[model samples]
Target chain A: METTHAARAGRGMTALRRTSGIIAAVTLTTSLAACAGGAIGGGTEGGDDVFKVGLISPVTGPVVQEATAMQRGFELAIEKINAEGGVLGQPVEVVTVDDQADAAKSTQLAQRLISQDQVDYIFGTIPGDTTAAVAQVAESAKVPFSSAILGNAGVCGQYFFPFGEPNASLLNGLLPQMIADHGTKVALVGNDYAFPRGYFADARTVLEELGATVVLEEYSPMGTADWQPVISKIKAAAPDWVLTAVVGADATALVTQADQAGILDSMGFTGVSLIADFYPGLTDRMHGLTLVGRYSDQLDNEANKEFVDAFREAYDFSDPIPSVAANAYEGMLMIADAVEQAGSTEGADIAKALGEGEVENGVFGGGSFNEDRFFMTETARFEIREGGAYVPVETFPADIEGITPRCA
Target chain B: MDAVVTLALSVFTLFGFYALLAVGMGLIFGQLGVVNVAHGELVMVGAFVMFALADVPFLPRLLLAVLIGLVLGVVIERLVLSNLYERGFLATLLAMWGVSIVLREGANAIFGSTPASVRAPIQENIEILGVSYPLYRLIIAVVALAIVAAVLLVTYRTKLGLVVRATVDNRDMASVLGIPPRLVVTGTFAVGAMLAVLAGALQSPLLGVTPMVGAAFLAPAFFAVLLGRAGSLPGAIFGAFVVALLSTVLRTYLNETLAQVVLFALLIVLVAVRPNGIDWRKVQWKPRTQPAQVAA
Candidate 1:
């Protein structure tokens, strides 16, 4: 009886070992499958017949309108390209990410597009701060970054191409003319943020140079509503002209408040023209206000007229086309042209081709990049009338005399 | 020289506005155990309501804005706080936060994404101490001060104030004595909400009415209430002034982010040193009553 019991115990131990081995094999297989799934799902590969391009933009927050316009412009350019024949005989594909106009998010989004999405090129960032944040990452990764919105001088990376006039230069170029027309005494008001503050500082310097006296300089935090005290201060100071550098909703508030206070009629108001996107609604209050900008709604160019007509038809209304959108659309076409010229999708080859001084027909007339990969374009000025429509006044070419070497 | 004076006047104008918001927040939190996260939104509503009625002229708009505030106050008490009294602090906080989000997003949807402005009814400027100041800002400051004085009078001298004080002390005893705790609580909350709305309407001419503007005021108002102690109206006002002065000085001399950091640090220290609040001595602590022995 003892021998039989011991034999049964040995058989039980053998059965236990076989069960443990089977469980271990199953766990190992499951782990491997999870790892394989992660690799396949990662956004690193572009499909066989499409050349993927990544577009990062601020599709929400304060700058949503401009961002929306840029996206539309980019889509229009892509459609035109596909109609003729896509890049390198393959259809073009676009992957979009919204940065929400945040600087840190823009940087992360750019990195994801370069490393994960594995896009052939990246385009769009509106504000200067966001542009600067993404440019460094794109430079290090050797990915070509084309900015359609930001025009700050601080954003000059070896791998970056800025497609608009710098904000400081745009204001500075118009300073002498403004002083000559509006007189010497000036009041400066701006949004207490990076872009406005920077542009206002530049405006001050240029105004002082043109023999203008800055009577009052004030800043309000972004989204502030009450302007009574600020307006009262303006009335007391009684500056000959008011130079405003506010953007978005804040701009509307400033103009409306000024009109209500009857300050606009008395003071010659000039702003760093943010008239392209929401000019229609502001027409009544914005009348007689001068704005400095790049593209005017009244520009008589065939490309501009077609773009405006197409945009109006799509929206079923006369929507203002921001110059940023135009620049972004042009940037995409320039990238496509460079790729064709280089005959490859390699970053270094495309960068070299872009800098080869080849003039091409683009949304902005006669588009070409300087040695530093900055687009050369003329600036325009517009006057806002009582009806919220912009009337083109004059166009000024890129101030070749003040073209300084890339600082960074 | 002119620019320096103009800057100083602008800073003072901002300070006056801050003081009004702080005092209102302080009064509600000090007397009632409710922390009003939606105070800024209440102010926003008042501003919009005032703007809509601004065409009726100055005095009418001001009166209408106050009435709107009173209505909003009662509505908030009935719809939001009545259900929250039994659930404790976390529930009240979450409820207020959710309400704020709903109000802000709702305003955005209704008004669209654009900001709307109200013209200051008065557009004159006054020069004082070699600096040019807006007459409108002066008017706002005077009105705010007057409102503060009136609130103090109502709280200290009125019979209703005594009932409110009694309710704050012991709700059970007040209810048992026919004081009607529900009526007092609702009345106090409604009054607080109205004050916030009044402050918002007064600020419309300077800042413009936007859905998100309330968030900016909400933070500073909370800071004032906490620093001043939860139930002291005067303390709240003092706290607001202190915060405004600190912010103004730091913003003028240092970087913007640094100014924010300094204010936050000061708040942390204030809380650490006085955990109960600046006016904790006013609260009465009561001993628990023992249960009666059971008869055998």
Candidate 2:
């Protein structure tokens, strides 16, 4: 009788436990899904009168700093534009969402922004993958989309415009400068992704054009903590300089491990990985490193100086403000100008006006979008200082036009 | 010859970190039947601790991380996990998953999403066989191995080990034998958590201290634990060795993408072939819970 009673209790306990487990799982999943979907700024709707733009920034992912800067630049530009009688003589509204750099999440958010929120334009995404995802959604809906990060690959939609430095603008100027300073033998190491692969391919063409030999091309996956093996390979190749495209948290890890492994001391290091945003994390390790890029906080211009001051005051950010912020802020101005020229918030009308509009000397020394719909960013060189500053070394003319567009 | 030395040292350094992580996970899973998905978050906590206490000396900071890990482990187990253990596997898994998100979001809220780093206590390099290896990495490897060794000694050679193992093998039978299963389970989990915290503290200098950084260590460490016999600690160590060796060798040879594919394939094959675990003679593990029913 006692054995029968114990057996019955055990079965009852099992059934109760399984039921509770299922309930807990369901509750947690629902709560998380809810938390992930939220909008920034006010709940003010974008009616026909307001120039509403949907901003997708990965504010919590590996690219959080870059994403945060993008959002700040977008919001700040809107604030300034609204102060100046707004875009098309009305206040410009923005609905921002954090995608966390996930492609699917960005896709879902983009759909909601278009079909649900009824945003006129979609702006911002850090990595190429998420950019492509957002572009796909925005294109089907005939909405204008732009990204503010560097490097591009794959076939994009007609409505897509990249405000970041294109391959030719970034590498055509950077590789030659690096090779002239270092040597012909160079290695390309980046995190294994579309942008890096395409970035290196562009670098290869430029190197071949300059009669330079590519010693090694390595692409490690994201989240790679140990870079010793990659370092050993580069050391074996004995490249005079190593141009890396490693990005996000992986950038810091690669540089830290490479520095510890004594690779940075031997090779001339410069690439997208050595951005101004990474200065604080690198500290004194990156001192004396030189790289060429579009914007520098030290750029002596009235517009840029004002921007730097405004950005610092608004965000209380002390480090060298990244070029992406400049790109986004300037891109917003360009967008507003296009909207004004078109006299309409329709996506096609805005795209048409932007194709003929100039950037008003925004951050990348200002230029108009080419027939290819690529923003021809200007170039300048900066030396990373001991105190985490990008001191301008040499300024290059904004002569490097973009590569041939590959939009489908 | 130079390349070989570098590769060997790389494997050794990686192995040291993986061993610490896998062993902790093994102990917790084996004793409590809870697959603490928040194990990696605990590591993130340790890294953040180092980042937060930047002015504190490195060694003392590591000690403090260990203490904090112990306290946090006890609190989590007692408050959230203790009641849920009898509720079955899914409950504990979901609970731990919830804990992971909370810790990650909490860290993000506190530290902000900007990645930060601290200076390595030892910045110099020691050349070995014509290869320069970071002195800090070598020291960390040695220390990790020493701690893992101490864990093994206590686990295999101590009476506490016997009581813990017995309770794990059969909770009801051990209870009838006068063993306090709850205390043993809690203590095992605390020690397990502390080890992971130590690994993170030691690795912080080489890492970009971010909330998401711990996510990187989770997969390989998890593979190390699950690839082994479910309850066997030594098996977890062997599994860690395989992971470190395979990853180092594969990444050394093939491009990282292809190497990762091949590595995943091979691990899956190994696990599929030896679902009962690649048994090693003379090593004892607590029987898995379902299997313990047969013993009962």
Best by lDDT: 2
Q: Model 1 chain A: which ten-residue window has the lowest total lDDT?
A: A1-10
Tell me the lDDT of model 2 at B61.
96
Question: How well is each residue in B100-122 modelled by candidate 1, as lDDT tens digits?
Answer: 77877787767644455666777
Off by over 4 Å in 1: A1-45, A60-69, A72-91, A183-194, A197-242, A249-269, A273-285, A312-320, A333-345, A349-363, A400-408, B1-16, B48-81, B124-135, B179-187, B243-296
Give the number of the best model, judged by DockQ. 2
Q: On a 0 to 100 scale, what is the lDDT of residue A211 in model 2?
A: 91
What TM value does the first chain of each candidate achieve? 0.83, 0.89
- Model 2 chain B: weakest 10-residue lDDT segment is B287-296
Task: Name the DockQ score for candidate 1.
Answer: 0.08
Q: What shift in Å separates residue A310 of candidate 2 from its native position after superposition?
A: 2.7
Question: DockQ for the candidate 2 complex?
Answer: 0.37
Residue lDDT tens for model 1, A1-408: 122322322332232224325446754565445323322122435664346787876765567666877877787778767776988886677778777777877877788778878877888868778887888888898887787764554657777887766664477556766787778999888777777766676677677767889998877766645454556657767898888876666676667667655777777887753465556335556666677766665667777777777666765545456777677667777778788887877777777887774544445567576655567776667777655556668777755333334542
Cα lDDT of all candidates, in order? 0.69, 0.81
True interface contacts reproduced by each model, as a fraction?
Answer: 0.11, 0.44
